[model samples]
Target: MGIRGKDRQIDNIEFNVNDISRSKTFYGSIFGWSFVDYGPTYIEFSDGRMTGGFTTGEPVRTGGPLVILYADDLDCTQLRLKAAGATISREVFSFPGGHRFHFIYPDGYELAVWSAS
Candidate 1:
């Protein structure tokens, strides 16, 4: 189905880790989360309720983890974030399923907005 705007779905979350294998094993053993390995540096998981990913080989940001949200209109979402005084940390980039951009909240938390559009 095509995406529709303004819903503001909190679709998934992602974390940057120093070791994908270690994080996968730890979380899997503790929470029984299942994982899918995209490569040596990337692994996705489902915690039975929600889906998220662990990333390695990249600079993990300092403000804890990344929270990702879904938007139907990527451009409008970004504009709204900018208008709200959020800092654009990363410009829009395409991944396997969609495109996304990272922004920093006023309190210094980092988040991302993504869209299939």
Candidate 2:
């Protein structure tokens, strides 16, 4: 058997903070989330179940937490998001696991839809 892909779920999340060290300490104390540093600017965290990351970067252009979702049909989902009035903030881009695009939801929060296929 082979591994299965996570689809139609909140697969990952990212947060931007001005101070990575401070954020790390706070989250660690409060939630016990463990982190692995990537560099001076990024750190990945494992909160027992879901994995997420933190970055010492400027706030996202549109603002809000970065919530990434999994989709089976990437193109169709993009079209549907557009039709539903979500603005495409960032075009589809490929990463190690798959491709994804960022959009501003109707409520003005930014979210991403990704496909592993």
Q: Candidate 2 residues 1-117, lDDT tens each?
A: 112466567888888888889989999999999999888888889899988888875474345568888888888889998999999999998865678899988987888888877
Which candidate leads the pack in TM-score? 1
Candidate 2 lDDT (Cα, 0 to 1): 0.83
| Backbone clashes counted, model 1 | 0
TM-score of 1: 0.89
Off by over 4 Å in 2: 1-4, 57-64, 95-97
**Candidate 1, residues 1-117: lDDT per residue as tens digits?**
346443588888889998888888899999899998898778889998888999975687776778899888889889999999999999999987889999989988888988887
For each candidate in the order shown, give its overall lDDT on alpha carbons.
0.86, 0.83
* Sliding window of 10 residues with minimal summed lDDT for model 2: 1-10
Enumerate residue pairs that collide in model 2: none
